[model samples]
Target chain A: MKLAYAIPAAGIAALTSAYASAETITIATVNNNDMVIMQELSDRFEEEHPDIELDWVVLEENVLRQRVTNDIATEGGQFDVMTIGTYEAPMWGERGWLEPLDDLPEDYQVDDLIKPVRDGLSHDGVLQALPFYAESSMMYYRTDLFEEHGIEMPDQPTWSEVRDWAEQLHDPDNDLAGICLRGKPGWGENMAFVSTLVNTFGGRWFDEDWNPELNSEEWQTAIEFYVELLGEYGPPGASSNGFNENQALFSSGKCAMWVDATSAAGRIYNPDESSVADDLGFAPAPVAETPKGSHWLWSWALAIPATSESKEAAKTFITWATSQEYVELVGEEEGWTSVPPGTRESTYANEKYQEAAPFADFVLNAIREADPTDSTLEPNPYLGVQFVGIPEFQSIGTQVGQQIAAALTGDRSVEDALNAVQRSVERDMERAGYLD
Target chain B: MSAVQTKRPWVGVLAWVIALIIFFPILWMVLTGFKTEADAIASPSLFFTPTLESYVEVQGRADYPKHAFNSITISLASTLLALLIAIPSAYAMAFLPTKRTKATLLWMLSTKMLPPVGVLMPIYLLSRDLGLLDTRTGLTIVYTMMNLPIVVWMLYTFFKDLPRDILEAGRMDGANTFQEVTLLLLPLSMPGIASTGLLSIILSWNEAFWSLNLTASKAAPLTAYIASFSSPEGLFWAKLSAASTMAIAPILIFGWMTQKQMVRGLTFGAVK
Candidate 1:
């Protein structure tokens, strides 16, 4: 009986001691390559701080967004750290859902972050999140195909030139499409590309008074051009293809040109991953009636949620993960080509990175030039080039994207789709009280 | 006899064709799991060197055994709990004839039609308030509630088909309600109960949405494990396939092993 009592007493004491010493911080992150690398390298952070344990909850992008948003809104205290984007950081920061990231150790060099990238993650002059990597849109084309076809791509091509190039290079008999673009129906999938197309074609989602302009002449022209281009020269089942599908198609030598996030440059230029790595060329994202908002600004960043009990430990981990030292560590451990790019100006200046990534300067210039605040041709009530930074934009954008995808798949006419998009947006804005 | 044999051969051939067609997607997934990432995305072709590289990478990246254990524990527990609650309710509805019994059964099923997302916030908040978030116990509870209606409905159907005379005889033999259910109803409805349990187990195992929302690292199951492979930048098709292959392997084996029993239970009342 004494032995049994002592055994239960010992177990209770052990459990109490174990609970008293260590602080485990849970981080909810997306399953992107850079975030995965961070997870792999997190052992160093754990080893350095023995008392602070790390628990990772990696989820897919949309699921991660949903989980984090649900947790933060309810103050469930499930996550200490969250991987959010430019769209959510500002909105959430303004709502005081995120912890302000203004205070950091001096050597962290917060100013080393690119202006546009950092600015996108800030709200009202306060930093809300630290950028893991930033990106802009650019055109990736096949150099060999262009050369063989005797076509010279300009430094900055117009949409008309791109269409003509696509027409000339299209070879359906050879199972090669002229261009691969995102057609998956999501707010961030097809709409991201479509919004830029509309912006460059002198259109906006909403005018200055928050009235939706989706049925405007500019939108009609842009939607018509998009459907015609993808329908004519795109691969079969293009409506189901998103960034990943298009990336796979482009990297496999099936696509002649792919206009997508500049962050894909690393994978597109890596010979191990891309079959056409040696035959790739880079150009600015295509323009139409205007140059404004031709490219989008986006940053995937790490932020501490207000509901965290382990805020300090989470902050420490975030600082370590997004620091310049982390960049150096990734470069040393995984080659220079695999280092997270477009976050810090110092990364572009590094001789090793510049040598490994020849398109660094081009990508950096595009990121610098993308202005989220003034992304539309007309005056608009929202920020974001590819997306509007309002909370309601997700559902609205996804609805419009589905309609646009219907048009792309020949399930609906462009005019009808745009009209439906306008009607939905109007209903949504009215429901959200954004419009009377 | 010769004419019957010829017709039987054609029926067998037709069955085989249908079975292969039904199985083609799984075969394609397993095949894609063995291909390199590049080759997986390459034009559909049967020729490619099979590699264990994706399996190696997937195992190295995630703790598969942990996720498998969670899947097993949560699924088995939820199914068992659902059976415990459902068997009694189904027995009552089948044997007892209250005027509201049918309406009550329909109402229970109607709750299933409401989208899981529609009540996600309230459930999430309730779970948090009750300190049930991220616990296997919490997940088992939600999954039990989520699958309870179906389990009840299935068991009710099976129990209804049971001969009312047997239960009536149990009462006539001076047995109480409990004794009647245990001695007469349960044993007689064993096959039906087994089928309901099997279905509940399968549904709980493959459920992703609630598991993804309600649980994080501590109690996450194989569904969450498979979801981790999907990235925003691109899908690693080969790795995703390998992860999926690993996730579904145990369930597939379990299903195959019990398929005979399941088929027997399903056909128990059909002929009669």
Candidate 2:
């Protein structure tokens, strides 16, 4: 009887002490380098709080999206903090699935966040997420090859000029593609690039009434031009190439020029990871007939789910991760270029960052100039530069990615591909109650 | 040299070619793991300076032994549980004729055909309700249920192949049902049972979907580990290959060591 009482007393004491000592919050994030750095330096956050613990679940972008979506929808409380993008923050926050991050401490410098990055993470003027790193698309080319061929790259090049340059640089005889672009069939994979191309060509996915306008004249011209350019001058099997594949090709000196996320600047400039690090040059993403949406903005941000039981603790961690102090810590600990970019104006203003990253000013301007709400040349209803800011956009854009691939592979004509996309997207919009 | 002897060398060459075709991807992955990130994407070279950069970085970022330990324990625990439940059911279906036995077996096999995503929500909710999410016990239970149908069918076939005379003799000698199954049927069908257990272990070890969805950090297996190395921002092929190499190394070695038993057991039911 005495032994049994002792066991019960010990169990009660252990449970109470464990419950009071620490509040562990789980964070689900992607495997990008910036997020990895956040995970690495979380120990600092733990040290500061002392009563909080951090657990991480790092997955690829698509996997993490699905996992976090399921958990938040079900109110499973599996993850306290979720690393999302501009694509998710607004839509989910509109549904009240995310906790509004209001009243952050003054030192957090909520005002220092770049406008586009901050606005993209808010729904109706309420900040719903804190950005970790933001990126905009741009053109990366081989300066050596440009000099050798006597080609002049414009400050803000147009598609026609880019086409002529691609033709001039075409050298299949020596295993070089004039240009490489994302051609993989996924919403975030190729659609991200293709949507910006459509925007610069003065195309919009929908009108103000939310009717899909995929078959507009501007879209046809853009798709036809895209098909002709990539089919004639792009790498063989371009349909299988995504951002990573294109990066690999360019860094290995197989592609004369490429266009992709500004975040890739660090990797492609790192001498250890890239062979063309010494010969690289960047330019604003090429425009086509209009320069309105030549570049697209995207960011990986952290937000607390409404289902989180430990909201206060989760807020503490996210605030620390997105603050200037955290940025300085990363700059000092992992070198200056490794600091998360495009989120804070201060990071771009830092001389240390400018000394390390030559493209800092250009990337900052690109991010600032990419206004998601007003990106299209013609007026449109969407709130994203490269995507329609509706949840249904994911499925709709994915199908369009495949349709574009079909055009590039010669399985469908440009007109035919756009027509198919137009019809399917109409059906989706109708079913989603947007058409009514 | 007779005809058989003359054909032996050619057959050996054909076998080698077929094996090489099947093994080429794994071989490429292992080789790429040792290359630098820059060299990895360069046009394939038969020879390059090997480095431990990727392996070192992967280990620094991820805790491999923790995931490996989870994989080992979950696979073994799930396999043992699946076998324990499968054997008696197989014995009952093979020995005692029931009207619904065939239907029951067919129905169990049909469960495997169901798309995992169809029931993912309910299963996740159930696991969460039971406080089993992200626990090794939860994963082990899921793996056991997933492998049960196949394990039962294999053992049933093996038991059917066994001569019923020995079991009848033991029964006549006053051995009870439990005694007869434990002492007689088990010893007789050891090869089939061993193969079923091994196959279950391999399947559970390489399982990705449920493991990824259910476990977050603590109980995640090597699938999650490999996934963390695949960056969306830029190329990290060498590190990804290193993680892939590490994930498959244990299973590859286990399969190789147990090749004889698996080959014998798989071929047993095929012939007299």
**What DockQ, between 0 and 1, does each candidate earn?**
0.35, 0.29
Off by over 4 Å in 1: A1-21, B1-7, B45-47
Give per-residue CA lDDT, model 2, range A338-359, as digits (tens): 9999999999889999999999
lDDT of 1 at B255: 84
Error of 1 at B251 (Å): 2.3
User: Which 10 consecutive positions of candidate 2 chain A have the poorest summed lDDT?
Assistant: A1-10
TM-score of chain A by itself in each prediction: 0.95, 0.95
List candidate 2 stretches off by more than 4 Å: A1-21, B1-7
**B3-36: candidate 2 lDDT, tens digit per residue:** 8758688886888999999999999999999999
How well does candidate 2 score on lDDT at residue A173?
94
Predict model 2's lDDT versus the native.
Answer: 0.90
Put down candidate 1 lDDT per residue, A1-436, tens digits, no spaces.
2332443355345434534467999889989888888888898998899989887798889899999999988988898999999999999999999999989889889899999898899999899999998899999999999999999988789999999999999999998999899899999999999999999999999999899999999999999999999999999999999998898889889999999999899998988888899999999999999999999988999999998888899989988988999999999999998888889999999999999899998899999999999998888989799999999999999999999999999999999999988988898899999888
